[model samples]
Target: MQNNLPTRKIIHVDMDAFYASVAQMDNPELKGKAIAVGGAGARGVISAASYEARMFGVRSAMSGRLAIKLCPELIFVKTNFERYKEISKQIRNIFLDYTDLVEPLSLDEAYLDVTVNKIGMPSATLLAQTIRTRIYNEVGLTASAGISINKFIAKIASDYNKPNGQKTVNPEDVLQFLEELDIKKFYGVGKVTAEKMYQRGIFTGKDLKLKSLDYLNEHFGKSGYFYYQVVRGIHNSEVKPNRIRKSLAAERTFSENLSSEIFMLEKLEQIAEEVSKRLNKNKVAGKTITLKIKYSDFTLQTRSKTIPYFVSEKAIILETAKDLLYQDTLSNSVRLLGISLSNLNTDSKNTKTEEKKVINVQLKFEF
Candidate 1:
C-alpha cells in the first residue's frame, strides 16, 4: 500500500523554547538561567518555560503559582508577542527560499512541503540541515527539524531529537517505526483516549493495527478510521499554504464563577469586544455569533445564531451573544465566557454586492 502512494518529502520545523529562547537571546544575563514567559500573578498561566525550568518540572499551561512552587528561582518574564512575530517572519522567509509550500502551525512551528523546492535540492535531509543552520546563524535561535514522506511521520520524528537537532525517517522504516511507538505518543490522542485504548488492550501501534476497521469504528466513531490509517503510516493531509481563517474568537477564564446575569453580561461584552477587534483586524466579518459558557463543574455549553448579513461590530456581537445567553436558562454558575464569529466572508471585495453563499458552520469549544 505504501509503495502505491505518491512519495512526497515533508519537513516539520519547530523552534526550541520559542518564547524563553527569545528572552535569553535578547538578554545575555538570562542565557543560562531558568526563565518563563507569562503572567506572574495568582491567576496567571505560564505560556512558555526554558529548558532550565523544564528540568525542575515547570511546564507551559501550568499555573504561575504552581510553577513558582516547582522552581522557587523561576524568573517570570512578560510575553513579547511583537518580537516573536518579527523573529518568526525571518524564519518563514528562510523556508520560502526553499519552498513556497509552507504551512505555519503557529509563530514558532511550521510544516514545509519541499518535494518541489525552489532551491533545486534533491535530498530532504540536506535541505533540512541547510534550513536549520541558516536559522541558527541568522536568527540566533535553534530549531528541531523532522524529515519524512508524510506530515504525520515528519511531525513525530521532529520531536525525537529536542533543542537543536534533526531526525529523518526513511520511507522503508515507516512501518517498523510506527509499530514500536506507544499509542499514547500518537498525535491527537489525548490522555482520556489513551486510557480508553489501554483498557481495550491497545497499548502500542502494533496493538492498534491488530484491531479490525469495523471494530475500531464501533468503539471510537469517525476517529476510528483515522487511527486505522495513521497506525499504518498513512496520513494524506497536505501542507496547505495560505489557508483562510475559518473563525475569529476570544475567551477568558474567570478567577471565580458568577451566577449573576449582570456579571455574565459584562464579561460577555468584554469578550465580544476582543472578537470584534480580531475580526476587524483580519478584514473579515461573519454572520454567525457563538456564545460559549463553561460551568464551575467543567460542564460546557454553546449557543449560536446566524444573522442575515455579516457583522463585525462589537455592539452587534454583544447583542447577539446576550440574546443567545438569555434564550437558555442558567445551567450553572459560569466559570468561563467566550465569543466567536464564524461563517466569515473571505472575499475581499464588498460582500454586499456579492451573492451570499450559505455555509454550515458549527461551534466547537475546548476546555
Candidate 2:
C-alpha cells in the first residue's frame, strides 16, 4: 500500500449551463432566457439547454420537438465548433498557468489537481476560487468550482453553489455532509437506480454505506464499487488532461508536387478513415477537429473546428474534413496533410447531485 498520502488539492470547475451560457455571452437577446444549442429542425436533438429551459423540462438528448414543448419560447442555434474550441484552448491555457494537472472534462468544465500548484497557494479551495474568478474576469464567462480532498467530493461541492459560485469541503465535513444526502444525489444514480435504492430503503449516504460490496455490485454493476467508496467521501481517481486524441491520422507527402483537387480529397479520405477507425475502437468522441496541411513551398496551414459536442463517428468527421479542405483554394500542390481531434470528454460526468462521484477523464494533446 502506498503509505504517503500527499495532501491533494483537488478542484472541480463546472460551467453554469455551459453551452447555453456561451450562447448568452455572445447574444444579449438570449440573456436570462431559455436557449438551447443543437438541432432546431425536425429530427434534431438538443445538445444543451439553458437553466431557464431546464426549469421547463428541457434536457440534453431530448428531441427538438420535445424541448419546444418543454419551453415554447426556447431559442435554438446551430453548434459553432470552431469558436468553442478556441475558447477551450484559451481557458485551458489559464489552467496551465497554475498547474499541469489540469484535466478538462469538456469545453466548459474540468477537474484541477492543484495539490502542488504554481501559485504556491496553501489551500486548494483558494486555488479553485481564484481559477473561477479568473475564468469570469478573463474569459467573460462564469464558472462554479468545487474543492475537496478528492475528485469525488470536489465535484459534488462545485455544484453546491452553482452558476457563478463555489464551495469547499474539507476532510472534517465529509461525513456530516454525506450522511443525509439523498441517494439520488450519488453519481451514476439515475431515476431508475435511485428508485431501486429507495425501494430498498436506502435514502442517505449512511444508508448506502450499510450495503455490502456484493449487494451494490449486484445491483449497480461496475459503478457499484465506486458508489461504495463515494458514500464515505473517498475517491482516488487522478486528474488527467483531455489532450489525447482518440484517433491518429497520418498523411503521405508527395515527393513531386501534385496540383489537383481530386488528389487532396483522396489524401484527406485516407487520413479521415484512419482517424474514424481509431475513434470507433476507442468508443470516444472529439469536439474539436484540426486539419494540418503543408504545401510544396514548405508553407503550412492549420484549420480546426470544435463541434458543438463530441463525435467519434467516421462519416461525420469525413464530411467535416471534406468541407474544410474544399474551403482552402489549394493554390499550391498539397505536400502533407494531418488531422487531429481535441476538446475530448471521454468520461463526461453526468450532472452532479450532492454526494456522488462524477467521473470525467481528459487525454493530453501537445500540438
Candidate 3:
C-alpha cells in the first residue's frame, strides 16, 4: 500500500517557462519580449509561450492564431529540441554530483531525494538552496525550487516562488500554511474540481481532511487517497533515479516542416542516428520498433512493429525506422520524428547501460 509519508528532505526543481527561457538565454533580444515557438501562419500550435505573451492570455498548446490574437507582437521561432536536450543533460550531471537520487519529471523539472547524500550535508534546506544557486551560477539560467517533507508539498512549494525563487516549509507550520492556501491550489485540483469542492464546503486542506476517507474515496475513486495524506503533509512517492529504460525512445522536432521526401529522409536519418547513440549508451536493444510522426498541422500518429530478440546497435535501429517509415504512404508534411527502443539485456550488449540508479528528489523537510 502507498502512503503520503514524509521524506526527511525532498526538493522540487522546475525551470521557469523552460523553452522560452532557453530562447531568452541564447538571444538577449528575446528577453521580456512576447515570444512563442512555431509558425504564426495557419494550423500552427505553440510549443511554448513566453511570460510576456502569457500576460496577454497566451499559452502553450494554444493555437498560434489565438496566441496572435492575444499578443499580436508575439515572435515565433522554430523549435531547437536538440539544444534543449543538451542543456538538460548538463543540468542532470550537476544534480548527480550532489546526490544519486534524481528523478526527472521532464526535460526541465525533477524531484530529488537528498536526505542522506554524498557530502553528508546536515540540512536539506541548505542543500536545496545550494543546488538552486549552483544551477544559476553554472548553467547561466534561473531555476525555482521547493523544499518540504513530502513530494506533494515540496512540488507545490517550488511553484509558490517562481523564476529563480526557492521556498521552504517547516513541519510544525504545515497545517497553518495549508489552511490558508486556496483549495484550488491543492495538487491535482483544477477549476472544475475546485468548484465542486467549494459547493461541498471543502475550501481548504482542513476542509478536505474533515471528510471521511470513505467519503472521499466514494466521490473520487482512486485519487481520494492522494488527498488524504497531502492535507497532513505526508507522501511516500519514492525518488526513483533509476528507471530501467522501459521503452527506448528518441524524438526531434524539425526547424521547419519537411515538404519534400528527400528532406524528410534526411531528418529521419538524423533521428535514427540519435536513437542509435542512445542504444549504445544504454547497452540494450529490442525487437520492437516504433516510428512517431507529427505533421505540420500538429496532428501526431505512430506505427510500430516488433522483431525477434532485443538489439542495441545503430545499424539495426536505422534499418528498422527506415523500413517502418515507408511502410505507409505520405500525404501530409512532417514536423517531428521519433524512434524508440525496448527489451534490453545487460549481458548480451555493451556494459555501459547497466549501472546502479540514483534517486532524484525526496519529500518532506524540517523547514
Candidate 4:
C-alpha cells in the first residue's frame, strides 16, 4: 500500500451542455427552454441537449424525431461552429494566462497542468475557482473543473460537482478516492467494458485492484494492465498540448432519404467542398479520401481510396467521392453522406517513455 509517484497538479475543465448552451446564449428567446442544437427534421440528430431537455429523457445523438417524441416542446436550433470556436478561443486564452500546458480535449473541454504555473500559485483549488469565475464574467459561460495529482483522477473528479463547480483531490487522498470509485466511473471504462468487469465481479476500483496484473491482462487484453495500474493510482500520462490530429471530416444528413446515386451526387459535392475548405484552413492535406454512407436503416459503410499524392481541393475531393459512391451497388437508401481525409501531412515525433520517479507522498503535499 506504500509507494511513491511524482505528483503533478492537473485540472480538467468541462463546459456544461456547450453547443446547446451556446445556442441559448446567442438567442434570448431560446433561454429556459428545452433546446437541442441540430436539425429539427426526421433525419436530423441532436448534437447537444440543454439541461431542461435532459429532464424529459432527451440526450445528445438522439434522433430529432425521437427527441420531439420525448419532449413535445423541444426547440431545435441550428449549430453555429464559428460562434462556438470563437468562445472556445476566448476560454483557451484565459487558460494561457496561468499556464502554457493547456491540452484541449475538444472545443468545450481541456486539461491544464499547473504544477508549476506562471503565477506560482500553490493552491490548485483557488486557481480553478478563479478560472471558472473569469469564464462566467468575461465569456458568459459556466465551466466545471476537477483538480488532482494526475489526469485520470482529475477528469473523473471534474464531473462530481458539474455545471459550474469544482472538486479537488489532495495527494494524500488519491489512493482512497480511487479505491472507492465505481468501475464504471473509471476514465476509460465504457458501458461494454463495465458489463464485462461486472461479469468478473469487478464492481469497484478496490475490486479491480485485487486482481493480479497477469490475470487482468489475460482477461481484458492490453487494457487490463491499464485498469490494474490506474486503480492503484499509478497513471503517469502527461497532458499533451500538441495532440496530433488523426483526421478531418465534414458530413450532412438529408431531410429525405435518397434512393439513387444520381440523387446523392449533389449532396456529396457539397460535403466534399466543406471537407476541402476545412483542410485548407488547417493548412494540411491528406493522401486518403473516405466516403461515409449512412443508410435509412442506420447501418454505416465506408469506402476509401489512397492516392499517390495528397490533395486539398474541392474538385479533387468531389471527384474521388463520386468515384466511391458508384464503386458498389446501392445496398439501401442513404440518409447521411460524409467525406473525410486522413494520413495528414503532420510531423509525428516519438516521445521516449520515461521511467516513473516514484517517491513517497509527503503527508502535506499540494494537489
Most accurate candidate by TM-score: 1
RMSD vs true structure, all candidates = 6.9, 14.4, 6.4, 3.3
When summed lDDT is taken over every stretch of 10 residues in candidate 3, the lowest stretch is 357-366
Query: Candidate 3: where are CA atoms >4 Å away?
Result: 1-6, 244-366
lDDT of 3: 0.79
Error of 2 at 298 (Å): 51
State the lDDT at 363 in candidate 1: 18
Point out the worst 10-residue segment of candidate 1 by lDDT: 358-367
* Pairs in steric clash, model 1: none
Candidate 3, position 229, lDDT: 67
Candidate 3 lDDT over 48-108, as tens digits, reads 8788888999899887888888888899988899989998998898888888989998899
Tens-place lDDT per residue, model 4, 1-367, is: 2446757889999999999988888888988899999848877888999999999999988999999999999999998999999999999999999999999999999999988789988889899999999999998889999999889999999999977899998877888998899999998999999999999999988999999999999999999889888898888888888887878999988888999788799889889889999999999888899999999999999999999887999999999999999899879999899999988776352234456444433444455
Over the full model, what C-alpha lDDT does candidate 4 score relative to the true structure? 0.89
Steric clash pairs (candidate 2)? 81-306, 187-356, 241-362, 242-362, 242-363, 243-363, 243-364, 243-365, 244-363, 244-364
- All candidates in order of TM-score, best leading: 1, 4, 3, 2
| Model 4 segments more than 4 A misplaced | 1-4, 305-309, 315-330, 347-364
Candidate 2 wrongly placed segments (more than 4 Å): 1-7, 242-367
TM-score of every prediction relative to native: 0.89, 0.66, 0.69, 0.88
Return whichever of 2 and 3 wins on lDDT. 3
